[model samples]
Target: MSACNAIASPVLDPKGPIAAAQTQLLLDAVAIMMIVIVPVFIMAALFTWRYRGTNRNARYAPNLAYYWPVEILIWGVPAGIIFWLGLHLWSATHRLDPYKPIDPEVPPLRVEAVAQDWKWLFIYPEQDIAVVNELVFPAGRPLALRITSDTVMNSFMIPGLGGQIYAMAGMQTRLHLLADEPGEFWGRNVQYSGRGFADQQFRAIATTTEGEFGAWVEKVKASTQMLDATTYEQLAKPSVKVPVTYYSGVQPGLFDSIIAKWHGDGNHLHAQVTGTEQAR
Candidate 1:
């Protein structure tokens, strides 16, 4: 498919360097495997046609037990492919580690992501604003996401930006991504939690310039709505296809609080909050 039609398969339609690298790696792996697969299928068809019962003149070597050249060809080719694949996979795993920050020269924008029931909550701690079922960030800037779930396990993914990571109640996962250019992409929960799983999707907007992102934040901040413990409790309840909503004032350390609440003991919860309170 053309890049213009990338919205249909976000994984194939990468908008950032990290995602573009991943897409290339995927294509390389498929191409390498097809090298062996295509030949094997073609040889199978040729052998079937040449040795068919109707072809009485076909050579038959029933006693062929140990042919060094044939044995080498059969085993060496697969081993070579496997070795090449292993090397690429190892390199990609380390280079694309989700925890590894991107573009150290450019400080990453921190965003706290919480997966609740059938919706997504994105809190911009630095900006002191929050939005539900919508995320906005500036293009050409690195994004560092700290993700967790308040309910059952879920996967936070933006196929056009980078890979997917799991989010569990009480456990926070990190993901780093960036947008090479301005565009809108799709984000969704890949893991099935309940009846509303299919509707658990959001829009990721990447603005062209820092000024545009700042303006968007200001617009959200102008909203009179507030997101606090009480409001969060209501939002946490199971819901489907929720409309995009913005909150002007967000409670401090709200993301950490949600993760802490899942811990069994009060002391652990307190410790978790204390350790993360100063974190942006």
Candidate 2:
């Protein structure tokens, strides 16, 4: 499972600002921990060799239970490490908050994400378009995602872009991410929901050229399929390994309506979406 997790998440190869920052924090933590680990390993090897039968002169401290120096070395050092690590984590947690806007100076592209039983749905509210199993945005631009699950709980992640954020039924989550360059990244569901969970994957395309994303959006908009409440009900049915599907148009407030289904209070999300849309 550990090896499978490593293979599934390509977090080491960070392609975006958030992922890069997270990778650096991981490296820093490991480096700090090695300060104690390396010394403990060296001392263990030395003690083993010195106490061997071949070395009869080795000192015996069988009656020894407490030594202040050793006590300080063990407890004090670890306590200090804990203190340092806590400070580091406290600072990083806020800076790398998933909900925090990556670049406030630049208006972010808003994308609504819905995790279904066996596939992912990405709705571009501003563009009035939606796609399944594919997410597209411009490179070097901030992307703000509003996520919720239409089925069971799922974790939405693009490992090279940022950390995973949970998408739960009835509740919305926010994740802000940015890609530094044009490339294709894999996005997947980290939580196991059912048999189709393994095939719940998507492609996240980052376009770099000016207007390249617009052109791609235009291409998607040309698709004949339209996603309305009826179409969505049919699409919501469980299916495995669905291909990349695009809907040129979507029913207005469809994403909000899905969230409203669980709460039975349709106006709350509607009002929130309206305020944010107006603010943006």
The estimated TM-scores of all candidates read 0.91, 0.91
Model 1 TM-score, 2 decimals = 0.91
lDDT of 1 at 82: 99
Off by over 4 Å in 1: 1-9, 265-280
**Residue 119's lDDT in candidate 2:** 97
Query: Over the stretch 28-140, how does candidate 2's per-residue lDDT look in tens digits?
Result: 99999998999989999999999988998988989998999989988999999999999999999999999899988999999999999899999998999999998999999
Compute the lDDT of residue 174 as modeled in candidate 1.
Answer: 98
- CA-only RMSD, every prediction: 3.8, 4.6
Model 2 lDDT, residue 70, Cα = 88
List, residue by residue over 1-280, the lDDT tens digit for candidate 1: 1244336437887889888999999999999999899999999999999999899999899998999998998999999999999999999999999999998898999999999889999999999999999999999999999999999999998899988999999999999999988988888999999999988988899999999999999999999998876687789889998999999978777898888788766455445544654454
Quote the RMSD, in angstroms, for model 2.
4.6
The lDDT of each candidate is 0.89, 0.89
